[model samples]
Target: MERNIYMNTITVSEFSEDQNLIFNRVKKTGIPVIIMDKGTRLAEIHPPSLPEKQSRKFGCMKDRLKIVGDIISPASDEKDWEVLKY
Candidate 1:
């Protein structure tokens, strides 16, 4: 059985002889290059994927947190530590 993939096809000899050219083409075009040997598929050279942009939202968890008890004064029967006396 034979397959005809008519994209960017290059033989092993061509790839070995002109690796830099093929690499540059793949990098610039972001298209994969198919490597073939004796008319059989061998390997593919694909361009590196671009990193995704991350979106950050400030106060996204606002009002999600609950205040259980007093924040300013210490808990009942809890004496102030000496380290806190500044």
Candidate 2:
């Protein structure tokens, strides 16, 4: 996981102490601020910027057949399936 330390942070109790400063930082800095309790992470503060770009490897639904093509295939010299019935 990516660890971003430049983001602001505050204890759970500090958040209750000054709501304005926390709100302002989130608005102006546009960075996340974590709320902690007893050194354990409790909550995060940040606004999502934009959706992630779609991967080019998968392309679109039109490539369904191509995906199936990548699946591993059985050996061409394999014995007949009738042996499986026994």
Candidate 3:
């Protein structure tokens, strides 16, 4: 499913007073707000997701098996790892 996670840009000055408005919006709708300060990006505020996605697939069982298989597969012998020892 395509989830709607919106990000909006607002000047830092405008965000100083309307911070509550931004927090309320994120809390209510789970959207994000990017605050810009003097033309440079400042900060981002948003509701946290229920669970963070796994960043390293090797940490999982299926991924570990797939990675191990790839490493031991006959095709893996075509490449040499000694050259990468440095």
Q: Work out the TM-score per prediction.
A: 0.52, 0.45, 0.47
lDDT value for model 2? 0.69
Off by over 4 Å in 3: 1-7, 51-86
lDDT (C-alpha, whole model) for all candidates: 0.77, 0.69, 0.67
Candidate 1 C-alpha lDDT tens digits along 1-86: 11222258878877887788788878888889899999899999999988998765997778899988789886644455666666
Clashes of each: 0, 0, 0
lDDT of 3 by residue, 56-75 (tens): 65656664443443554556
The residue-level lDDT of candidate 3 at 44 comes to: 89
After superposition, the stretches of candidate 2 with alpha carbons farther than 4 Å from their true spots are 1-7, 48-86
Q: What value does the lDDT take at residue 33 in candidate 1?
A: 89
